[model samples]
Target: MEKRLTHFSSGSGCGCKIHPAKLEEILKDVRSDVQSFPNLLVGNEASDDASVLKINDEWALVQTVDFFTPIVDDPYVFGQIAAANALSDVYAMGGKPLMANALLCWPVEELPAEQASKVLEGAKSVCDKASIPLAGGHSINIKEIAFGLSVTGTVHPQKILKNTGAVVGDVLFLTKPLGTGILSTALKRGKLNENGYEALLRVATELNTIGAELVAINGVHAVTDVTGFGLYGHLIEMCKASEVSAEVYFDKVPKIAEAVQYIQEFILPDNTFRNWNSYAQFIDCPLPETFAWLNDPQTNGGLLFAVAEHAVDTLLNTFQKHGTTQFLLEPIGRILPKDEKIIYVKR
Candidate 1:
């Protein structure tokens, strides 16, 4: 007799995305069209976080739209997670969010409209925190529940962060940990515990505002958010685009404590396999058993940054000095000159 949000979800958060390799298949032709428009600074060609269109000599417009089915049972919390996930793109590209419109889909007859209002309120609360306005959105009647934001922001034309530009000797770091996908899957299967839920909510709701701070950091090179394709998948995108390879330390990469337990217990999201299959050929995994942790898709995840070796301290100091959100910063790996393998994962 109670209403549940995840009950209507087909996939949780970014886990709902098309599998990485499959997505490449779908976008292959679309990627070739990127060169047709010279003003399109960052497009699908590089697998960057958001599309950056140059506006003038000084500025470029960063625009992205993201939506996902519920990742939490509470409508309000689900709304927060979805909005944070969508806004992450702008930050990943080193832009500050300016405004947004809502995206909602629900079964009107099955769920009360009041619940949808709660979802909008949750998204609005996050937008307000980011100092952006939620102007409007489009809604539709659908069988499954979903919500997100169409965010627009601005960045200096010269400073747009792309997946390209990660040079060799660049130290790598993930602003957050992995395992949102696994935990959200556990939640959907009714197997997740309170600790797991707390972990998921904390990571999903925290905005990746640290991205905006990176614009001032000279060391920050290529940056991308770890999302549906998992950390390795997104990192591979960065490597291929930047024409560099990586050395990811398996133990150094952070993970949610609860989610780690869930994985050890053999709880995994379907996307884990989807992600691995998408790019498994390109990686050299010395520890094959740890692949699940490495490829677990994330929801509203952290920004993965490639910082110059000399600027590593400057980058970490920025996180400490940002003084707004707390980051569980960890140096997971480093960029290497392109080798036959795109990534080499070791303990």
Candidate 2:
């Protein structure tokens, strides 16, 4: 078999290929097949980040696993980003990770196992920084190099956050800027600016430690980290689960400064169109021609949280208190009345 040559192929990560419609289709069958258990707080019925299983009346266990192929060239950085990304799902659901099991798929014939071990070491470094242990892991020889972790976390039963809890009038906030997909794609094409390139690596490698801590502090309502599903893809799920409509101010969205220029140059990842075509249903407002391209998928992205309207200031202050004053927090949208199915995006 020929070695798979790398291309500036898919957008940032798996989220780019995920069309909102295709996900709904797959969910239709899976949702029908699965039986609901009372102890499950969040599951397949709604596209939530992690599954919450009751451990006791007061505590619940949040568990999530995610793995993906190389999105960057540096093995250590790739491992760090992958580990942070996997642990993010637990944080998205407002949980403190306890332990993680490493997951790896590498081509032993094509790459050295020592290199893979280094990747695991990188992931371990990240987990350790978060005070979580890499308890165990599973590996296999595969056609491509991939790595991530299956993390178990805990949160108060009353505090278990899900995408479905955003209430009407709640303000939406994103802890990181958009455009990771575009920056990474440009990097692969050798077209990325220095600042954009730096931004992508910085955000991807940074843990969601602060965001998770903020969610636990209170006032945060619904939460989900941006991943393979572009921003709107995840936001729509939040709206649907919360039974609310949303109006997003496109101008307010934080994009990497150079992202719009790159899109204007028509440099885009293939997943851009795929994401647009999939999640265009809930969107009712006008979008710029470049909007589709800018909403590209992200990997190891930041946390998107909806806080009570009055709590917006508190959230931003809390973030500043944690030294994330430059997090690019923005009010891209607000929850609207339930039963209004539209997700309006506008200038």
Candidate 3:
């Protein structure tokens, strides 16, 4: 019998992440004296992508770890998505991944070891594409089947990008369409088509390498990859860190075609509500259904970049030159001066 990987898990992909509010409360009491080490360029002080430690005057090391339950039925595709999602953190910080360590949790009594081997092979394939080594990792028997990577990468100290520099008047660009969470939910319900599955796999597995390239563009102010928290949550974090507000055009936001259908059908992950409950107080969206995409938890999602107004044309041109489709480089909104509202959604 063919075992469905998602069947054994409660949450799908990055949707398994704890609610942002709970996470903040959990980490609030934890003492992180990052200021004690001047070399810590970026730390837990801000909800940035990765922790960066300066190795020298020129280079800094970017470190991050992410793991989650399977979102796809195929173990190989799940592995690819998990690894790509983990590697996204380094890329989000404008860094090149150098190595990764696998993190796996298996249900020995429920599934066979062969399935786990396929998952490892899937991760190795992605690591090979990124030119990184899967150095090592640890595993354990758990109730759910989970897998991901702890990725390490390097970037120039001067060029390291963080989500803390978004400025008023900067334009926001989303590198990929929204709706992975919705589509994954549909998949779990056996409502997703083969085309939808292919779309999800393609988008999730594709590395957000554009972030690293944006480092050469001086106007690129802030870079953050949209993942578990969804667009609104991550944007809120950026606004708070940079002390800026955002004006997003709901109509302009790109979304996968299949996701739109699933959303219309009211198929959504459990985290959808949890995500909204965590940050709804800070966001001003007229329609409640807008949260379907705004707060929908994305797994290996796209990078949400803030670029200077004057450089928006250049950014688009660079993406075009790099063969990125116009659909993928959609301009969804702009940053605004800090105000009473952290996010303002224009319908």
Highest-scoring model, lDDT: 3
Better of 2 and 3 by TM-score: 3
Ranking by TM-score: 3, 1, 2
As a TM-score, model 3 comes out at 0.97
Q: Which should have the higher lDDT, number 1 or number 3?
A: 3
Per-model TM-score on C-alpha atoms: 0.96, 0.90, 0.97
Q: What's the true lDDT of residue 157 in model 3?
A: 93
TM-score top scorer: 3
**Candidate 2's residue-wise lDDT over 298-343, tens digit each?**
8877788788877777777778877775637668778888654558
What is the C-alpha lDDT profile of model 3 across 1-347, one tens digit per residue?
A: 88799999999999999888788898897645776888999888888889999999988999999999999989888899999999999999999999999999999888999999999999999999999999999999998889999999999999999999998999998988889999899999999998889889878898888877888897999999999899999999999999999999888888887787888888999998998888888988787768798988999999998999888778988899877887767689999999988999996
264: Cα error in model 2, Å:
2.8
Q: What is the lDDT of residue 115 in candidate 1?
A: 90
Query: Which residue pairs does candidate 2 place in steric collision?
Result: 15-228, 15-229, 20-278
